[model samples]
Target: QQQVRQSPQSLTVWEGGTTVLTCSYEDSTFNYFPWYQQFPGEGPALLISILSVSDKKEDGRFTTFFNKREKKLSLHIIDSQPGDSATYFCAASMSNYNVLYFGSGTKLTVEP
Candidate 1:
């Protein structure tokens, strides 16, 4: 009942375009939200994320829109660029201190 599914194994965009990534889960009990961004051969870093109680979260050029009732969420990359090219993973947990169950991740590439 605690599974997160991601889509678009990979995607490409322009240097200054937009990129959208998605994630879905079955468990509504999972409240913690943490999106991680990973570069090639590197570990993921904590990106912007939203709690189940909130509808949105943003940091810099990244944003996360969450729909708790739907058990779904998405990440929108504004002004996507080559530096933003990385693997984005969606994860959830019951609490911030708990371990997060991460999605396989969506590979995004922004060409200049």
Candidate 2:
């Protein structure tokens, strides 16, 4: 079974600080990696993603560092703000597989 795991299930950061979330997966067949952010009563929204062929992907203040060999990845949130508080889920899927395996999630709180 494909499984994804995340550490420090919850995190707290001061505004303007950086937040880091760690995630790991079991399946080597997984190719696509995506991170989603969900707020109360709202569906998750894609934050950033990276391919197996890529080691790092960044957009604005969000960055995903991937390690294909170890089947691990880390999501970094820079310049954190109070509005950034949310639950983040790390997910992985294969190009041919329609299912996405997601980590438990990391709830982040940014203190202003």
Candidate 3:
């Protein structure tokens, strides 16, 4: 069974627009939420993360929000550019372990 579920398998956005990606998890034990960005040939890199204790986290133009009660999380990209076009994966993990449960990912395209 899939522990984490992500919506909108693919997405398209115009340059300088906002991009929103969401995900939900079945496990309530998940404490750490991380969003990863991957290019065509490169590995996924940690973009931003938030702990269950916090409601939101922001890094530059990227922000991640977590709802512990609802077991839902979202990643928001403001002023999205062509360089931000990539596959984004939402993952959940416990605070004590390194294991991660990842969603299928959302393919994002930023049209210039």
Separately for all candidates shown, the number of backbone clashes (residues 3 or more apart, or on different chains) is 0, 0, 0
Which residues of candidate 3, in runs, are more than 4 Å off? none
Highest TM-score: give the candidate number: 3
lDDT of 1: 0.89
RMSD of each: 1.5, 1.0, 0.6
Q: Write candidate 2's Cα lDDT for 25-86 as tens digits.
A: 98889999999999999999999999999999999999999998888999999999999999
Q: What are the Cα lDDT values of the candidates?
A: 0.89, 0.94, 0.95
Per-residue error for 26 in candidate 1, Å, reads 0.6
Identify the candidate with maximal lDDT: 3
Error of 1 at 34 (Å): 1.0
- The TM-scores, one per candidate, come to 0.93, 0.97, 0.98
Which residue pairs show collisions in model 3? none
Better model by lDDT: candidate 1 vs candidate 2: 2
Pick by lDDT: 1 or 3, better one: 3
After aligning candidate 3 to the native by TM-score, how far in Å is the CA of 54 from where it should be?
0.2
> Cα deviation of 84 in candidate 1 (Å)?
0.7
Sort every candidate by TM-score, greatest first.
Answer: 3, 2, 1
Question: What TM-score does candidate 3 get on C-alpha atoms?
Answer: 0.98
